[model samples]
Target: MGFLGAPVVGVDELVDRIDPRPVLESRTIHEGYVFDLVSETADLGEAGTVRREFLRHPGAVAILALDDEERLVVVQQYRHPVGAFDWEIPAGLLDVAGEPPQLAAARELGEEADLRAEQWDVLVDYWTTPGGNDEAIRVFLARGLSPVPEAERHEREDEELGMPTVWATLDNVQEAVLSGRLHNPSTCIGVLAACAARDRGWATLRPADAPWPEHPRRR
Candidate 1:
């Protein structure tokens, strides 16, 4: 506080808060199956009004499934935009009507890896790109893993067909992430968050059903 007579704010006080601006105008530029592009003009109080365009996402969930051996279950999926087969965690959009995020996470884990978990906790929630998209994603830590029955497994299609699933040590995943080998946002975030949570004995984790007020559907 001595620097320039400015008060020093506590670290805890830096928490993100809700302060939504009123939108003066909004228009959908293009609607896609996954997300929609929209333009908005918002009233910024004394700063005057501003117009911005962003993607209106439906939100998503990712699972950081850790096995008994401290290894993470990861998958390889081809992303056309990036022109690479990215290593990523099992994740899917929250598109289904009235489905809980946890349930959607379980469905994605089962569909992508044929796995199920007995315990679940929320690892982290974040916006993928706040400047240009409203894609809010929640990553969940899932343990006590088990395989889904063969007859009950989901059939893969499109980009998910023949996707490769790998089990790698957490340390190796961290190293790969640090080396820029894993480019998927969810994988990078989940891996790093899992490491941090482990260091704190996972006491900072939120309940699986914790509220997500930032989700578009919730708002």
Candidate 2:
């Protein structure tokens, strides 16, 4: 099955079972928080079948928080891999198989930013790094936040992996990205999606929009 002229490729059978050799591979073993060792063993043209082992994960989510005051809630924390702080949107992984992307988005907001949204409108779903891995990211826009005291939330090692919570206007976000303050790729994409949705008058970020799942226009 091909979407266009390119044939849809799928791993249908096992040929060779060998641990991926780092030297023979083109990608590094560890990237950021992910172990990204990719197998470079696909057929080119006249070569025999080649196969390699790789790790697979469920996928993840990122949330763009917008408020009525025109503020964007971001997080700043040091990423051990880069040895630098990243200002990014609230995001997390979906550990449970078959877990809904929307639920993961809502739960990540509570864990990472301590803010509850009345409504969440999904903006986009995409792959963060599509070269070798299949991990997809679901981006959501959360509005009508119920302010939970920042002190009440406990940071998990993964959540605290880089982002810790900072509030900035859209202008500030743009400036930070320009000044080397924000470096997370997924966050940047989410911010742009949020901005686009906001322009269409689709986001609700203040408490006035509270208890959002109850709203008729939210979905």
Say which candidate scores most in lDDT: 1
TM-score of each: 0.96, 0.64
lDDT for each residue of candidate 1 in 1-219, tens digit (9 for 90 to 100): 758898889899988886789999999999998999999999999999999999999999999999989899999999999899899999999999999999999999999999999999999999999999999999999999999999999999999999999999988999999998788999999999999999999998999999999886786
- How high a TM-score does candidate 1 get? 0.96
Clash pairs of candidate 2?
A: 75-165, 76-164, 77-162, 118-212, 143-204, 144-205
Residue runs of model 1 more than 4 Å from their true location after superposition = 2-7
lDDT at residue 7 of model 1 (Cα atoms): 83
Instruction: Tell me the tens digit of each residue's lDDT in model 2 across 1-219.
Output: 576676666676523332333333344444444434455555534555455545444567788877888787887767777887777788877775656667878788887888888877776666665445556676777779987677876567853844557788876786767676667977777776666667877553333222322111122
Off by over 4 Å in 2: 1-55, 149-152, 155-163, 178-180, 203-219
